[model samples]
Target chain A: MPSAAGPLKTTALTRLFRDMGARMVDFAGWELPVQFSSVLEEHQAVRTAAGLFDVSHMGEVEVRGRAALEVVQKLTSNDVSRLGPGQAQYTALTTDKGTFVDDIIVYRRDEDDFLAPIRSFHFIETAVGGTKCIVARTGYTGEDGFEIYAPPGDALDLFSALVREGSPHGLLPCGLGARDTLRLEARLLLYGNDLDETTTVLEAGLDSIVKLGKGPFIGSEALTREKERGPLRRLMGFEMIDAGIPRHGYPIRVEGAETGAVTSGTFGPTVKKSIGLAYFPSRAAGVGTRFSVGIRGRDAQAVIVPTPFYRRAH
Target chain B: MSKGNGIYPEDLKYTKEHEWLAVNGGVGTVGITHYAQSELGDIVYVELPAAGSPVVAGEEFGTVESVKAVSEIFAPVSGEVLEVNTALATSPETINKDPYGDGWLLKLKLADSKELDALMTAAEYRKYIEEEAN
Candidate 1:
């Protein structure tokens, strides 16, 4: 629990992070490790070998009933009917207006049981002192990984077990800083930074998962209409050509005219350049389109580039 | 080769912003302290001002960017920039690898030599950071 101005809430691995000399920061009301060794080192560790992360702050919701699949199908954009037990699918809970409620990963445990990963709030009841627990192969980073759900009391033990098991593979304990850079290099969309309630799935370039031909679900009608009408704005990737680092909320301009604002921006470790995502008018959102980003009161030259900036060799 | 916590050089002056100034014959070499680089975590970019730029004491002169965030670097003493470390342009990780040596950011020709007296001695800086941690 967090007070008004006190310290943020901690996960089970918080003490372990401190013991390892991690630098902590308040993220989404949780006191999480931003880095232990260094962001660059941890990021390279994940790319070349493997890095472990304490993502216990992510929320879990268990839906168990005869209508479990129906409830999930009604709420998410992906085709839930295609998911068999023990499988997981990336999805988004959309509003009636075809905008995001939240992006999530749904794990179908059984015909009547499903687990959805959210931003906050842990579903520890299903993990501890319960009959069944489902571990799913899912991650926000564009690497192969698994997210484990366990009871709050069991979190420490689980984390320790993972550390012990993964030690031989040169697994280092990673933190949020490495996580952000790795995901950004992969061009994954962050919820608050990339998608919001007012931003439609089509506009966010997530049309593959929006199966319109499937039977109706929440926001299906609006999404269908959107499919017919096309999106007004599109999220695009950009790399800085001139010297300057673009930051979130920086103005994106075209020929001295303000066009859009950067949604997320950072110096990508893998890419070895400053990269970012921003909304551009559909007409100007083509690959190689030149523009400028406002960085430190100066217009830095930039150009739209293809996404998934650094894809791992599969 | 230097000693003292294996990071902070005992003879250098430090700023509250975590910058260090090694003054030699009224010309000071400026760089971020070991604490700054450790806190920043794998610096990916260092934005430096051009040579001959006038830098005022306690004012932001440049920025140091890590993967997670960007931080402004403040000048420890009033001076004119003599040279900027161009090596950092292609290899910013030098700040993390050798913050005190190869990572030195800039060389400044001091405008007021006495300004160096206002900066904290290494012992005072160590104490100051310890207090801040508490």
Candidate 2:
């Protein structure tokens, strides 16, 4: 196998994954397991039983000092004042254009500190190689889970300890394949694939997190204007009515005309259907709005449906 | 033909794409190899071409979608599809559990028997996979 361009970084549990015969793929710049056994198996495990995930590839940024909450509130789209210590909220780091810098989970550690779980698009200065760490109740997978942020040297021990403790609860070390499917089933947007710098928070179907009235933030002006104008396209969920699986970048067509495109698509293991998220014109964005997805060269029938395709009973 | 790793059947003709053809007289039964199903993780959906559809060797006949990805199943030999295993629509995991038996994809009436000569035997296919793996 040809090596990855740069030296592929290994997570704390990389050796354990290799020993378990995990199929590894380079994600971002980190060598991570795509699956250990099967995506369906791991996905079902998370839905029914608990499944451990080594999401150490995700970056951790800490904002601390007396003005920590102010800094975070100014940068993120969500209201930081609402988060109590030990609570975490899904939020987006936005640009001046009201588009996403990255979608992140902000965990309120204390009055002076907050931990943000961000994708590896770029690293913030404070948290890199920092000694301070915190455990937060947050995860991309729509499960009751906690993410632990620690120094690089401490990651492996923490991961190993989690595996050891969680083994009895049926926590198999999950991988990116299961992670992607799980997040998709939960209607969670992935940064690069679903939400990019060009797409505004409202268009990405994340208006609930944009707390526009919470006082001025980086993107407040544009977001307020976009809110008043109404978004042109809205992100929505759809299920395939035809045999084919809808994949990313497949054109979304309405009445034989291209209307939008799929951002994230996969066979949802838990839901037992091929489901996807896509941007559609506002007129066709309602639930049950019928459409077709261009799968390969043929049009497979699809329809806009309610989101979070699968939710736990609790 | 020879079996390797006790998975691939020695009687089957194999393609580099990992499909196997079991020829009997003029008709052939086709399915993916154990290695293919194992590599694909969980098979959640199988889209088979309708019966009577014409297929050409080395061309896509249908698709097998796992939770992780959708993979095209290529025809190993040119033929007309006579039957599709509809049982897969409800239980696609059969491909992972028994890819050679209950997981068989289709039966085809061979258009030209000479096409089988181009396929690899089980032993050759195993060697090909081993070489590719390295």
Candidate lDDT scores, in order, read: 0.84, 0.84
Return the TM-score for candidate 2, rounded to 2 decimals. 0.91
lDDT tens digits, residue span A1-314, model 1: 25577878888888877777677788888888888777888888888888889888878898998899888888989998887666677888999988999888877664454346522212212352332455655666778766666666777777777678777888888988889888888888899999999899989999987988778888999999989988888999999999877888999998778988999888887778889999998889999999999888878899999998888887
Candidate 1: Cα lDDT at B27: 94
lDDT of 2 by residue, B1-109 (tens): 0122447789999999999999999999999998888777788888889999999999998999887778899999999999999999999999889989999999999
lDDT of 2 at B42: 84
Runs of candidate 1 exceeding 4 Å displacement = A1-7, A111-133, B1-6
* CAPRI grade, predicted model 1: medium
> Tens-digit lDDT track for model 2 on A190-294?
999899998999999888899987999999999999999899889899998887788899999987789878999998878878899998888878999889998
> Which stretch of 10 consecutive residues in model 1 chain A shows the poorest summed lDDT?
A119-128
Work out the TM-score per prediction: 0.90, 0.91
Candidate 2 ranges with C-alpha deviation above 4 Å: A1-4, A111-133, B1-6
i-RMS of candidate 1: 5.8
